[model samples]
Target: MQRKFLDYFLFDKKDNGMLETLYREDETSFPPFDTQEVSFYLTPEKRLSLKYPAGEKQELSYQGFRDNITFILESPFAEYFEILGSPYLDLEVRTGAEDLDLFIYRRAIDENGKTVVLKGNHGEPMDSFTRGCFRLSHRDEVAKDFDKVRVICQPPTPKSGVVPGQIYRVIASAHTGLNMFARLGHV
Candidate 1:
């Protein structure tokens, strides 16, 4: 399972080193988390349909995209809280661009407050409408406290309804991981 989990984004030399440092210093490591994905049509009507992955990779739709955002915001996952406090990943996103410099770093804390930071390499944006995976460490041996990464989509303020063709931003953070999918996704 460790090797299989490592195969996704760990093969790259940079990712490999990050993983090594993570595992070496952290006692509890977590597997990746994925949302149920659907397909989004780029029409004016904003059509969304469900899609089941036949093999491995999953496709995500736009309605599914909206639902995902709501779930992430509303869900009480530990990762969400952790991310809120960390210098995780904050991105100024531009759709269909490859020059996004996304990175993560440990936040600094003092009597004043917390300070966010950007670490090593800023990741390039994958193509549009793709979910970015965040790898975070869990706290307990049972891995109850988990870290998290998230993509934040910020659009121009809506005139009436949610605006279209605006912009989406991505930020990643780690707090605690959520067991939302455990017990057959019953959470």
Candidate 2:
């Protein structure tokens, strides 16, 4: 999905201070889990569908940006947040400008398996025709095991019939944290 910070937040087992999953960039200001607001998702219209601190779900619109480009969205410091990382290029983020310290996304899983799509760009923006999106595969079909699933790169080859870089955040029902040990396939 089109995320501002959900994708890049560092996933540290010892210290990934994540909160509930919120949609609208403004949700960072919403309630927390202990104080509580849970996870969030994007609607087809790009609105953020999330849980409120009172334990209710709410759909929100993008608050957009200020003249400085900083998000109007922000939250109080969270007790804990579970940031997700993909199998492809699990980068470490030491700093972030998005002020979401509360409301973390509780991992998601679909009929497919444990999955996630925080954010990605396979190639440079200008040369996007050769860019690719992350792809998913499972080691087993029926069990849909988290330990057996992986997010692989769609090779940046001109011959691959799929549209280059067209896919964005499509990973669903993510299991928290990246299984960095997964045996990834083609890049």
Best by lDDT: 1
lDDT digits (tens) for residues 126-182 of candidate 1: 222112333221111112232233323224332222223444433344333321111
lDDT at 40, model 2: 44
Q: How high is each candidate's TM-score?
A: 0.18, 0.21
Q: Which residue segments of model 2 deviate by more than 4 Å?
A: 1-39, 51-78, 87-148, 154-158, 162-187
| Candidate 2 local Cα displacement, residue 170, angstroms | 5.4
lDDT at 107, model 1: 26
lDDT of 2 by residue, 1-187 (tens): 3343444444323222233332332235223223332344333333333522344433332332432111111222223232333322221111122221111132222223323233223212221112222222211221233334554333333322223323222332323332221221111
Model 1 alpha-carbon miss at residue 20, Å? 24
